[model samples]
Target chain A: MSKKLLLAASAAVLLNTSPALAASDADLAAIKADIQAMRAAYESKIEQLEQKVETLSAQQDQTAAKIATVEPAAGEQVATQRPATMQRNIKDSSFNPAIGVILNGKYNSFSENEGDVAGFAIGEEGERGTEGLSIDETELNFSASVDDKFRGSATIALAEHGGETEVEIEEVFIATTALPAGIEVKAGRFFSELGYLNSHHTHTDDFADRPLTNRAFLDGNYGDDGIQVSAVLPTPIYTEIGGGIFRGDDNPAGGAEGSDIGAWTAYGRVGGDIGDKTSWRVGLSTLQADDVSRDANEDEVNFSGDSDLYIADARAVYAPTGNNAEQEIIFQGEYFYRDEDGTYEDTGAATGAVDYDDGQSGWYAQSVYKFAPQWRAGARFSQLYAGDVPTGLVGSALDDEGHDPWAATAMVDWTNSEFSRLRAQYSREEVADGQEDNQFTLQYIMSLGAHGAHNY
Target chain B: MKKLSLMILTLGVLVASPSFAFAKTNIFACAPEWGALAQEIGGDKVDIYTASNANQDIHHMRAKPSLLAAMRKADLVICSGASLEIGWLPILLNKAGNNQVQEGGIGSVMASDYVPLLDVMQEKADRSMGHVHPEGNPHIHLDPNNILFLSKVIAERLSEIDASNSSAYQSNQVSFENSWTQAIAQWDNEGSHLKGQQVVVYHKSWTYLLNWLGMEAVASLEPKPGIPPNASHLKQVLQDIEGKNVKAILIAPFENEKGAKWLSEKANIPIIKLPFTVGGNAQSTDLKTMFDDTLQRLK
Candidate 1:
């Protein structure tokens, strides 16, 4: 009895020191006194409990002894006594916070026949063959809430960059449900309000290779440091409006040199059901980037005029069955235009061109069909046209007459489980200027625990 | 030409007659179990659709335009919400443009509301715990007791939505209850073979079902409750169960079984695959069949 009391007292003292308990000195002292008192009370109560346990133990022993004594005479029949049923209720709602992680790794081998034959030969010196599998994305995502209305999530990914593994913040944001207009606000580093592929993690991408438009236009893949405010509008139409202000250099490849450089983007989407089997959505987004230094040589180039980017996107998805894993056809298209005026001197002479704007537009139509529960086949056709390229030394290397790159992608993917997928794809990339590339990519994505929410 | 026009007009009138108009009650279920139950209970009176398919993980479903459309025209929407649909359900429901299925509306039914939940984070839940449901565990549908409780609630909701077929709904509920009760008894009897049997599971999703069967979940492959099994954690679990008599390693079809298979190989135990929900496995096509298959697997 005294031992139990001592154990309980020590447990209370340990609880007082725990960071999770969060007790002040005064509170700790009071709790200690209360625990002492509890121990004294339990000391007496322990006698009763000990007596009951002893009685039960004795009875159990007596039954065992009786069974032992009868077993010899009854032989094998008595030895076959059924074990007592142990009824346990496993389902209980308790506040138990669980932790989870997702580790995705892959190996890549670019075909020798792909890419420009001469360019490939030159690039081969830097290219490394497949020595072993590489960890494409290893993410640690954690989420918790202080209360019902407050929750936050942070995702960190350890990925290979520049031949070394680096840790990058994928998502670090806190969401508050207690909003005036059924709104949720998140502030952190996150993907921009851009296309579908931009918001999705690379591991969750449908195809092994990202589209040419996304790879060339969207800076360093996807994501940026920003704050986003989103809300569901209460209207007859299913509508959502969101806007964010992000640091200019959110992309890893094109980050802002100064912390003050920033950009703003706003997006609105309206969608509704056409019938039992069909649904559609129309979305429009406008992004504006402030005039800032284009590169480390900030003084070498200057913006001739304000540059604002506009993107208009719309998508329609149809499913014979409205299920996430069912066979469906998703048609999405977006138009992107960048108009900018800038002045720069490269040959000891300042040159300025008005309407030095470049309009790059691309749209893809894709269809995915589930041939079976484990297998799916999909195909997509995409085209990108870069119009009005400035022909000058000051213009970035992007200056060209124009290049219209079109691609046809075919993929076959298998879903072993909800958390695991293996996909193989063959893509033929062709440009009007006679640059053709045929690429084959195989990718495997495996998730360990609870999946994350779909990003915008 | 006049005869062809007359025939077309007659056919159009016949097809457009009000008596011949077919309007099936549209029911949208976010999970597969609800879809199965809705189909079973509504019979020919309703057309059902599930937002999550058999092959996909329901935890990370994206809200597609088609799902929103289905919700928009749906007369009733059933979901297993204890934050199970936190990722995309909100967007889908809001985009559905159907006020009836919005939050606090009669047409919206959260299956967890009727039953007790498990593994609710009493402490403030955070992202550190991979996607914890703030309300409570929404996987309660796996337990027969919860399903029994939810069936009555679903029947009552169905009656409320379609008053004209109230009696029919009630009758269907009675039949379903009777069959479910019988199935539960059979399961209990069959599961007696596994009473006190200790097993290791991959995820906490099987807690409710394991509890009902009186099975002991001695340990898990995951170090943290919801985390995926890593090599280090798998090593620890293997060491812990080295001398103990762990009859089987239980896993859900939706969970990654590679860890379980590796553990089974090292521990020399059979890997018993259990369905997380209806349609998750071939044997678990419906609620009743899910129970039967789960019990058989456990035994």
Candidate 2:
């Protein structure tokens, strides 16, 4: 007990010596005010030692040095050597955020007549820089617990397209804590937590690219500034329900304006494990959006008004050895149904507004098997097989409706370590009648610093 | 179709029933060691769910739905905190939505807090420090003394959460303490060769164990905590170990072996993989066996 007190006293003195802390007297006040209850527990003891802080910081160089000479700690927290250069701004060092970076690069080769599957528009999604080397995505992540009531995380994506670099704030969110009834509230620009794979970073995906249904309905992944609340029901089985309101800036339901939330989403999931070898989860989710100005097929056709998308996702895993790292087989699939009640405007040849009710749906299913250490193989099949559009359309609009488009993808990857992976994947794609596009890609994903655990 | 629907309805009733859920306390342990420890204390009264198994890095876990499923059902959670599980535990906790097992709750517990921590940070954390634990070294379970401390805390916590089984928990703790002390004594006598021994380690994970046994780790394979070995750092390690009487290069079974292999091949030192937790090796089926195997391998 005395040792603990003495260490705290010595540490307090060292902290008071920092010029930053000294100058920011109000910061200490805020800290004290923030922990009124905690301050009461230690205030008497700390007050008694206030007179001792000045001389101790100067004299505690040896003390810090002595502690530094001991064995270094493991993982992220090491209180190792601190040279003289680090003396000035040391107050908030203890509560600094964890930072991490992910570098994703891929090389792709695609046969030129790169056609599209009939009646399907894959959106801004396609092979990565077909026939060239490209840095697909570089992400900078920062996260920290913001007091006991909230935690904050932000991710910024950096990408270069056509010799120009672009930066996008992929996600920035603050999640609430201490909520009653097993509830959490997340606010900011974040991926909607409706589907299983929607919230995962692209770099963490099992394959190099998004699935066909995802690319179609979600325009890749639905990311928007929103407020989300989720609750876990008090029951024996694992069940969760969540809902969100978002500023509609995403695809499929793109372009909404003003203060009203453009998109509203709700979802429920139920899951559990069987014995020790098998686990499964199934979810049903829905999103409703009012697209103020929706353009597709190169602006020749535009949609406006209400649209709704419903999705169902299910996943299961069987680990024959009961150790995931050793041998595991995973099965995942998702289906989407979309209905749009909007007016389509054809600007090109037939210039008129047609009140239309269009319904489309797509699905994808994939399975991955880890047969040996450091080796995994997976295959996925996706299709944009259904859609109906109104008449009085011209140019790209007429060409956009019709038969089915489908794709099949397969990949094999070798992981050198937990932080690095190399994968080679192939895709057989058909856009329009016999417009076959053979695509191959080699991708590398390397993470540095405090990368979080990816969701399975 | 009607028969299948009827069968599904019956299954749902069984799943949602409280009697099935309350038969035993469900425990979620972030690491295998904690799972084994929970089993020792809880016995048949609890069902232990280990999030990470032997030879799997606990820092990060594959985002598996079973993880959330276990968390949702867990009556208690035990982990080596001090940010050892900082990467995955936070999101898992929030996503699981089980307020009973969130931080500061009665069911959420960290083993590092019950014991005196080693290598506690006194400096501010910064990127330049690599992966520095702001609290202290969280690998307190490696020290048998710390395990004794944790056993008491866990038993108390279990009793607090499951009052009906208080006396049983107490008895379990007593038996465990008695058995653990005896094992520690025997291992101490056998590990006398380890006293004043010097070794090279892949990471700083074994500091508590080394300190407890009066052994020393002369060098590390990593350039810094959480960072992999670099060429210059490996070169420096080679030069540093050129003349030292280091016994062997100790690497955790879960860690990448390339660095240790390189050091071993370059320095002509032997590399020994340590079963880091229960079930880490064929012989390490439990805590007692884990330490026995670790001690035997070190000797």
Candidate 3:
């Protein structure tokens, strides 16, 4: 009975255990299915996420491109705010070098009855024909700015001198404005500070022929190698002061050296607007040269012990309407003085010489009247006097002693523009020795392009 | 000498009067059109100067010393800045030595500033592209709408500089606008016929005008925007335009006409000469006349 009961119980237990195991298997299968479903859902979600990202990136690119297309340029807006006048006056600061060449050719024929001398290029005996065509001036100018503070200008002229091509330095100077009080410093070869005509170029002179004072005192367009400093003083009146130190030998004729053969000049000028329609200026200059050679002697002599020159100039211009281009009047005058200590050395009868202490003085006055927009008439008178000289000189010894020579000039000019001019002038020169000469000249000036400079 | 002294004294009195102490409102206009407009609006109250001369090629002017002197004393300065004056205007202003018209000064104004510019390059500007302003084309003065806006700006400036003359300045501006309106109406009437017209230009200078008139700029005489036309470019342009119904070939008086003329002759098209600026042609002395003459010439 116990065995039978135990077997029944075992069977019951087996049945219950098998049912439990079956239920556990079904639960495991359900759990596995749930895991597979979750895995598929996660994979699909990741794929969708990747597609969304790509679409967003493409939209961002499109937006960026549209932004670039719509934006206005920065430079254009900045330019629009500036004043028109200021904008019109703008300039490029970059260095753009320009090279230029100028060639001048002239031909003249005097009317019959005008006589010609050996050096003169016109006329036969008592009859003048065609004067040979001459290249009056040929020049090459180079000007540039190294930077904002430093600038340089140079001019070279090639002309026929003494039947040969001669090269001369017309202007070679470096100017700097990096100084105090509007001061400009110039160094190298440059023209001397003397007279109005002396400071102007041959092409810029009002008249074709130079004044007698310029010819006599300047001695063939005086220029020297030197250093110069000029400054415009900040004052109620327009004032300028300039000075320079030069090697005396650099003068056209070459200065003699024995004891410091150097030259120096200083000048001061004051100018101001007298009124709305008028302006005036007065200037004084002093020059000194040491150890100058005189009388063709091997030894040099310091005249005035060192020779002193004084020049005083005054100018007044009246423009009743304040438009000188239409109608105006101008008056100018200058006085010059030179003092020298006389010295002499005799070598023999073959080279005769005499010595005396003397001084020289000269003065000139000019008047100009403009009657029309482009027409002007002017007149000038100048005189020069030399103090007594020693006797026994080869050329006009007695006649030149303590005598005054004078010249009068009348001119008419027509200016087509600032760059072109036509002038006609007649002059009469009279010497103390009773020799009188008259000359008439007609001149035409044409500028090739836009190379004209401003007048100071 | 006595007569001269008396004359001098009389001249002195005139010059020393209190009325002569103040300088006139010195205005600098960049182009002849602006100059004429300034003169018309300012009347005798301001002295107007132009950077480009009537008889000169505006694009080729050299910035000279005399030009600087005029700018140095200016009370008000104006320019078409979109690079029109890029070649030399900056240098002239710096050297003019005037503090009143320098950058950031009240006296300075640029006409292009008030208007939107066109034809901007998306890439960097270089010489290979002929010569375009890196910023854009600055020739907005050709548009009448732009001029109207610019005139208002000028009136405001005039009033600021001379407060006492504000009423007069406003009145002048009103009259100028009225006249411009009348002129613009006439221009519209005439320009209506030119709509959709196909034209060839010598340079990009006419872009503003062409855009305003709704005319198509079929091509340019220049091979590229800034490059001069070569034989190959000209040939290509001619071939492209064959039987394309081009009405006119426009060229500015300042530009060399040899290439344009050659192209016109080869293409059998009418060559039209436009003034491009005030006082540029005999019929275009003032701003109103300039537009009238330009329209007439185009017709």
Candidate 4:
């Protein structure tokens, strides 16, 4: 404001200094009057500038005092790379951990009274969700860099199960941040990176429920206390290889005998872009569980032995519109094969122990299309084939009754924003011969707090 | 036969080696503008891999494996920051495990940290405000001065990372500063008439640009930031901009143009889709042309 006034005043003075070609006495008086007005404006502007200077000096003094107090800590632990102001903000935010919460709820309807699939004893969580309106797992997450060398994250899930409120610590892990040579190491309890979807949180799933293959093969989810190390290769194409060792206390793996390692996993993944609009990733993984003692089908069945599982996954995404945020189609599939040689017993039916040695496999294929910015529709088909059941185990939950289980599901979801989604899904599965289970589910998953970017 | 097979195996190993043949520093830019800026400052001494192009929305970017691979080898990582790339950059940095470009590393350059920001939330912000960044708007590259400031930062980091080419980076930055300063003066002269002119915007994407040109943003087509424009919101905008002398409805290349088109037709004003960043349009192939094309279109 003062600069413009000064410029006008200077311009007026220059005009007056120029040769007076046609200047009369009245013109001179008018010019003098203009100069007087400009002087008054300049006087007020100077007063304001002086006030501003006074305040600035006062602020400088306060800052000097603050620096004196902070100087002592600076000597003890020197903070490099971060500006002083940013450091102050980080301190003010109480360690600066990213905190987030996911609110998920669902209303489910099922035609069949029992959700159990014959021939395969799915785990507790693998069963269908609450039959009526109920809140699903609510996840509370917190993550932050512990230091320059490590970063930590934890997730706690709260849900209602069998008329009881259940709180479970789903994942808690610390990962190395500064490992050289593209190698990362993580420790603590985390989901096993067995397949593509297993590593991701269920809230990020394209459908409301896990695929039949995932449910039967890995019991909806597989998380256990473990340590994992992964390395991204230096190749131009995206390639990563990882391995993990876990305690054999989770589904597909049970009680470990003493301090021995329960399960171990190894995986390799490769991905790249096909064009400007499409990208794809393919991965192969294997998990081996030893000394397993598992009870399934509400304790009516017991299996104790070693189990080995292998998985192959493939995913491809094409953005019909250049902006994937607007429109896209995703094709994802996973196949799992498990070979187990174990002893099966029916505790409830008092069936005699039987020696079982066989292999079981399941595969699922799904496609989701985002027809509009907010709307998406998806369809999935899955089938599971069971191995031969010994005579003693025929009446137990492991009995297949010579029928393979298969399911078909269709769903449509609307995203209000990046943080919220509402979905409706319908599915039909014949887990046993001539027993069709028709299921309908309405679910909402809303995220709050920190914005999380989806991983591909 | 064994000796011949061994020789061929050695040859295959050499051929499959992953090390780069050249000595140029690897620069992973989160957006196209930073990629363009890195080019201006690093010149031929850097190999830049920009994660997102001008036609894609960086806010909605996925943490793709390809980006992870690129980040894994990055000697330097440049981004607008201030939570603009918060969704994906953190994931990439964590997964990349590259010591040079990790947070607090010498090669990390978050542009917003250096320049004064606009729209920093004064009070507690909430989700009702629509994806507000408490740190402020991250679109700092729109101001040419901000770009110049970031160029110096990028050059300094490049020098620190690849000190053997320090002189080259410094000299390149000097030349870019000279040309850019001249261009800024020219733009100031040409845009003087645009001072205080009002226009509607599709999003707050052009906050820094409008502020630099002394143009006023009368309203936004979207009801809020990150939200698509709805019928009620468009109607409200129509009423708000009525007789406000809104010269144009400004939008970015990646922004949906439907709301802008509807508003333009209803308000009888033109819709100007700005290149927004480098590679947004044919005329905006580089940093200099991006600004030049933006001003040309605005006029």
Candidate 5:
């Protein structure tokens, strides 16, 4: 404001001082005195303006300092907003873990009640449960890279058993990322890298339930605290070998009283693409547990010595569309051979424990055909190929007659989008004498968050 | 026996000779556009492989063993990061177990890191908002200006990865920049007519295009970021577009045409299925042609 007024005043002074304004000495002296007064007033005003400018600049610096100090408040703003409208500040920790939740619900109808297998000590999550609406495993998962050297993932599950809701820590693991020579070490409670289906979450499975081999051999997806170190060979073909030591907790491997490391697992896999449309992978895995104990369908079996399990899996996928994989065909199979050396006791009949050495095995094969953009049909056949137990048991559950327990299942699923899927499955089986094993299930899986991709 | 041993040794040497002589780096790109960009910068010093091709949704992908094999053999992995390859790349990296291309290594180049991104959500988005990237928009290669910055990053990395061919990569950077700058000028002049144009898009995929061409996306067919349009959103978009001077309805090739087709048939606006990236169409075989085709469609 002052500068503009000063400029106008100076202009007036200049206009009056032109050569055209010729006059006598008395007139010039009066003009000069007036000009001098005006000049003095302008000098005082300019000095005052400079002082005011400095004061304003200081005030602005104060305001900027306040803002700088309050910068941390911006972080609290992110969590304060609703999830749908929260702004993720890019500069706030350059890395964020992807969070995901998967919800699975199913309705089942069975011809007979098979929830309790008479002879075998059933594993946790052993049965498909009641014939009505039931919730399968619901998983909340988080994964991210912690640093240049490691990435981590944690999964917590809300599972239901006989109308009881239980919270379980399904997986918590940190994997080494910067290890040289194609080596990685993953440490935490995780699905053991033993078999094809043991490590995969139930949501990633094609079928609503686990296969017979996985259920029988690994006690329905074995999970425990372990450290696995895997290395991929530098050879051209894809070859990976990994070994782990786990605190035996779940079935097959009976952990020590205080979470002792009582189980060991190792696996090797070879995979490669055959052509533009076909790819295949083959893997071999083994698990050794100390002092495994469980009831095998009425035969109270306890293995005081080492129990060994061997598994082999092969999978092939053919996508007609190379990258546009709307339709595809997949063939997969798994085999398990378990040998246990222990004592057999029939607690139901109060039979004393006796020396026993037996081996059990199972196998399953499945084929899936994705016929259209949003639909797929698959069929699987699973059987307990071999079931040998200690003789003189109360129930003849593991006898040769009741052995060869097999089921054939067929399913069709329609995926409306990547986030949702509905599947219907039918299975016919007879695990024991005089039991009807016809079952039907309609299941829907809704994924609400970021889901990791399934492995081949 | 001696003769046979010598023959086998000779065969091994013959097979190993090429690797020692050239030692070209193998690059595995999650998307075809990145592969093409790598090819542009790396030239013969690198062998390029792509995980997703044209007309394939980069969001969901099957974990093919061959992709793992490619990743395993890759000396570098270039991808459109920001969780764009979240579905398949992690598993591939885990299975590949290759340290060179893991997240913090020099061999891992995320194009999103080099280019300034757009449409980064001002707020947190969840399933209710459909699928939203927390790290802003992951589609950075669509903007030609991003390519200039990314090319420099690529050249710098290629020089570091394959130091023997530093000059080749550096010269390529200069030549690529010259041609790219010229092409950008030509494209800008040609695209000047698109100024202040209003468009309808099926998704937020084309935001960079709209931002660059001075175009406004008044309405999107999708109700939310990733969700397909339902009845109300469609109806609202229809009413909102009324008297808006909308010029075109834009869509990418991979998007299903049902929604855009419905909107087009209802609104009488021409639908342009723009090839969004390299190999989007036969004419859009590379980066330059992609923009050329996109601008020509605008005209």
Candidate 6:
């Protein structure tokens, strides 16, 4: 017991000496040195504890022998002793939340600069990433069950944008756990579950970047402060229905009035296993925003009116091997159609206004194959159909110029374990007429601390 | 319009009600072993659904929507639970929206909570340790003694949940204990020759079984707990097992056998594929026969 206390004290001393804010290289080195010292101390202390335990167990065996000779219930005594050998002192963890952190970095090379998609105004975060080596987003997550009735989770992301470090709250919400009749309620800021991939974090992506369809339609991810109510219908197969009302400050919808719902959504999904080797899911969803101002092309274009979007998503997974541990293949795709009755204003280069009443559509299909436990290869193709531009706004950002945009991407990634992954990707993108670019990317993602299980 | 509304209301009522008039308590077993155990204790008084079969690794379940559908109707949730189901069980519980089977609820049965666990980490675990569970190894069902102990706990939980069938559950548990105790004694007497034998294992999953039999694991094919075997690591393991009088290389049904096969050929040792759980093989149809098959294979 004294040794345990001494070890604790020494650990505290070493921890105190380590730098708290390890943002710089010097501070990181100092922290590494501190960890090394602590590890050495713990190793020696563990040796001493092992020696002490050995002597104590020797004495215990002698005492047990003496007791065995006196007691006639030796069999029962042995039965009880067996459990003691297997039991270990466990730490109590009732009040603390599980914490996790994600580290992302990438090296990107492009043959030409990113150009706006012809006839489509793209929002921020929808464009290609910076060229060259850079640190991507660093996410910190915390989650725990508040009680039997509810659980809460929060994720904060820090990224370097335009040479400035910007911190954003990606998601923070509380969800119901005890509602009856297969009902669940979630409230606060979260990624809206409009489509299958919309709610998934970027860290869990199969490729290093979002597909072109997601970028053009949803600004990579559509999320906002909202309340969502969903229910898993009691059925032999899997079926779910859900809806939400959001504050509409996110990309697809912007500029909300106080206490007014800017957007509303409804979605339904059905899925089941075909056999032991295959599982498939299909979903349909829609989102509507009314009397809200939306902007795109880095805030150079603006639109205000009623906008409605419809989505269809499908995914199927097949494990060629009996178990997924050996080999598996996944095919996923999503189609997006948006109809708008709004006025588009060219806020930048071409200053004009157009009374727009048209529709745009986009779709992407991808397939990923896990040929081995730690290796996966995938390819994706995305294409978009531009909307018609009024005669008054022929040269505006919304003008189609008789060309549609498309991109094809291929990637190969190696996962060292569940906690770390490295990937290489190549893509040919044609965002506008006569504007073609070849892109290459090498990326690494490492997760530290407690990461919860991802939903399928 | 009025007639249409009335017809829809009647259909809604029909779908809302359960399909069966005499509904049994719904048991959602996370693995085949627990499902088999629930069968033994629940008898005809419970409706059982096993989430993952013996061919799937419980640690890497995909949290499929079908699992959520099953969990939504569960009256009891049973799992090994020393973090063995950490990857997906929590998601199912949260999404299932069934309060009675949530953690710490009466309908939740974590078998590790009742039995002692092996391979409990002595220090704070890091990912570098390769998928180590700080609470311990959650594969506790390998020990027949631990299964006997857990049976009593399950019986009490079931009786409390379904009071009208309390007597039935109690009698089933009593019979299970009697047979299990007798089987443990017979196996012990017949399998004394396995004492002090050394074997190589693909994973630490066999810890409880080895501990029960007084056998030891000399080396592992995996370099770490969950890391796949590489060439250098296999060479190291080959050298480590030299002159150790190693009996055989053991693997579970779901585990990839490529590594074990390579090592077996190199070391000139035989590979033994143990029925790690119920339905792992043709003969391992239930809990009793599963152990019988495992003991027979090991011998």
Q: Individual DockQ of the candidates?
A: 0.12, 0.20, 0.06, 0.23, 0.20, 0.30
Candidates ranked by lDDT: 4, 6, 2, 5, 1, 3
**DockQ score for candidate 2:** 0.20
Model 6 interface DockQ: 0.30
- Residues B96-126 of candidate 1: C-alpha lDDT, one tens digit per residue: 4455565445677778766667776778765
Q: List runs of model 1 lying over 4 Å from the truth.
A: A1-100, A111-133, A220-222, A251-261, A296-306, A321-326, A343-355, A394-396, A431-434, A452-456, B1-61, B65-78, B81-299
What's every prediction's RMSD, in angstroms?
18.6, 17.4, 14.9, 15.4, 12.2, 17.0
Residue B110, candidate 1: C-alpha displacement in angstroms: 5.0
Query: What does the i-RMS of model 6 come to?
Result: 6.8
- The model with the greatest lDDT is 4
User: What is the C-alpha lDDT profile of model 3 across A246-325, one tens digit per residue?
Assistant: 66653222455554436666777776556445667788876666554432212221121345567888877776544454
- Decide which is better by DockQ, 3 or 6: 6
Residue A95 shift from truth in candidate 2, angstroms? 6.2
lDDT of 1: 0.63
Query: What tens-digit string does per-residue lDDT give for candidate 5 at A187-278?
Result: 99888877678888888788877776677677677887778777666556677777777777667777355655577777888887776567
Q: What's the C-alpha lDDT at position B74 in model 5?
A: 80
- Global lDDT of each model? 0.63, 0.76, 0.63, 0.85, 0.75, 0.84
Model 3 Cα shift for residue A365 (angstroms):
2.6
Q: Which candidate has the highest TM-score of all?
A: 4
Which candidate wins on DockQ? 6
- C-alpha displacement of A215 in model 3, angstroms? 1.5
In CAPRI terms, model 1 is classed as: incorrect
Q: Best to worst by DockQ, what's the order?
A: 6, 4, 2, 5, 1, 3
Model 2, residue B142: distance off in Å is 2.8
The digit string of per-residue lDDT tens for model 4 on B1-299 reads: 24324433543454345666558999999999999999999999999999988888888878888899899889999998888887788888888778767766777888887788999999988778887788889999999999987877788788878999999998999999999999999999988999999999988899999999999999998787888888899999999887788899999988989988888889899999899999999999999999999999999
Report residue B136 deviation for candidate 1 (angstroms): 13
Q: Pairing residues by index, what is the TM-score of model 5?
A: 0.80
Clash count in backbone of candidate 4:
0
